[model samples]
Target: MPVRYLIVDDEEPGRINLRLALADYPDWQLVAECDGNAAARAALARHDVDVIFLDVQMPGETGLVLARELACLCEPPLIVFVTAFSAHAVDAFEVHALDYLLKPLDDTRLAHAVERAAAMLRQRQREAYGAALRDYAVAGAAPYPERIGVRSVGRIEQVVVDEILWMEAAGNYVELHLPARTVLHRITLNRLEALLDPARFLRVHRGAIVRRDQIASLATGGEGSHRLALRCGGVVPVSGSYLAALKAAMAF
Candidate 1:
């Protein structure tokens, strides 16, 4: 199967150049292109992109800030920072699924990054499968994972589960949202739900699970649903499918 990719750069020339370079690899497909961080995020929401070739410098939101936000995505795309910046910026990317290519991306370097991304994506699939099996086998397993592991930059980061404000599903992974950081964990929401304390966390939507105490307000969301406003100012959508559970939790 061809790997779907996204290109995000403020400069039309940069986007064009990347497009031309990517054409050499027939196995990779360009699914979308965005001019800024907001556009890139919107594109991601509308399409399933496996990799993102991003520019670090832009007018409004820089690529580094966008990368941090992307890190929180459930199944974040492989982020390749296509920038002219020096190696110092490498530190910021070290905590997420990322690669860096100095300005004027080379075919050889791009090929190497693509190869590594393929291996990472494959490993992610295996991890998701194993997680589902483990979840099915354990009915009431205690002692859940103390630290959730997430890939960042070029290393694995362990995030404390207790600090997570909520979790949301994104494709094959889970987004663990914290007060200060969002970690993209390579695990299914179903598999993760089993490990959390039921009393503290509640499934508010098929794609979302939030800490009970973290909810700030629950209001009619229109269309027979509820919108849970969090203390952090992020609102989570609650579908009718989970309305009963959400209401019951609020009553507690």
Candidate 2:
């Protein structure tokens, strides 16, 4: 499939330079061009674009503003900022742009950005197709997930569920305690716990969840309080509100 492109720059010369640079690539198709952010958003709604070659310093609505809005979208296209100023490179990437290109259009950098965008787009397409195939094969049946996809600063990592010994609630994030290391995942503890298998995992406290097999011993605390020691030598407290469920699970 051809890669669709949307160009957004205030100057006509900048747009023309990008078009000339991309014309050498057979797989690239220019879907639309807009002078500003509003026009760009309209063009985006009208076309399925793979990459946006945007100018950072535009009059009125800036490219950074549009990029930030796109970043919050469920499926944002790859963004490559085209600008004369090198000072805005950090700001452009902070908005999750795939690449930043200095103006007067270096042919080498333009080619590299388009290639990177194409590769990323192809990967996302393949993953989406694979998911659709799995859903069709299941025929609406639900299967437990073995791994969770974690989106971090600049990349996504797949974590094995079985390797997780316990999980704790952090402010606006969940910490997954694994054997070798702990990962601060940007997901709520309650949401992550729901994805886990109920039989194999248990919510021992309001703020903590533990793998069933990882529980090594249940220790006593003051005033009839209880705490759980894990096979990994880590200990977690069993709140009074959850003590009954813990007792039931232990057959006490």
Candidate 3:
């Protein structure tokens, strides 16, 4: 398969430059060209991109924020930061970007980054195949996963389902709140909800989902406002649309 990629840059010239530079590598294919983070997010959901030639600065969301959120993907696309400002080079590497290329793009540097992305992408493919094999070995017993893998930089962390207290929808990502910390997973709230066992997790609001056992109290206020007080000392809004279902789920 060709190495699919997306070019995300606010400037048209930058996007064109990267697109033309990629012509040298016939193995890499351009899936889409996005002008900002929002468009990139939408494109990502629609395609199986293997690499991203991303700009560091943009109008709203910076490339760093997008990269951090992408870390949750089982196989994150290789990131090659393309920007004029060399100041962000450190920040780019912190997010485990494959390489950083300064603008007025050099042919030699761009070629090197492309090679690096190709190498990393192949490694991830091998790892994913192995993971699928492992999952298949025990998939018959439980249709829903007991633990989820969260990828970051060079490592993959296993998060137990029972340890998740709640989840919040953040753009194209889902924030998994655990006892010790919160993890950003590169998936929509609805998609994540579908993967979890319904008996253990309940959607309390359009943007929130909570573990059934963590509901400490249902606080009601004026104007039909409702809130869920959790045992972990956190509160989540309870939308009226889901109120009746919440009550029934709690057996009250």
User: Which pairs, if any, clash in model 1?
Assistant: 93-153, 94-152, 94-153, 95-152, 95-153, 96-152, 96-153
Give residue 170's lDDT in candidate 1 (0 to 100).
94
Clash pairs (backbone) in predicted model 2: none
Instruction: For candidate 3, give the lDDT.
Output: 0.75
Q: Is candidate 1 or candidate 3 better by lDDT?
A: 3
**Residue-level error in angstroms, candidate 3, position 220:** 1.5
- List per-prediction Cα lDDT, in the order shown: 0.72, 0.72, 0.75
Candidate 3 has its poorest 10 consecutive residues by lDDT at 88-97
Please provide TM-scores, in order, for all candidate models, with all chains considered together. Answer: 0.49, 0.50, 0.51
Best by lDDT: 3
Candidates arranged by TM-score, highest first? 3, 2, 1
How many clashes (backbone N, Cα, C below 3 Å) per candidate?
7, 0, 0
Q: lDDT tens string, model 2, 11-52? A: 998888788888899989999888999889899888898788
Error of 1 at 221 (Å): 75
Compared with the true structure, the alpha-carbon lDDT of candidate 1 equals 0.72
Query: Over the stretch 1-252, how does candidate 1's per-residue lDDT look in tens digits?
Result: 788999999999999989999898898999988999999889888998888888989998988677666554555676778888754344223222246677787889788777766766666643432232232223213345444546543334556667889999999788889998788876568767766668778898989999888877789855666799998878999888888887787786
Task: Arrange candidates, best lDDT first.
Answer: 3, 1, 2
Error of 1 at 187 (Å): 27
Give me candidate 3's TM-score against the actual structure. 0.51
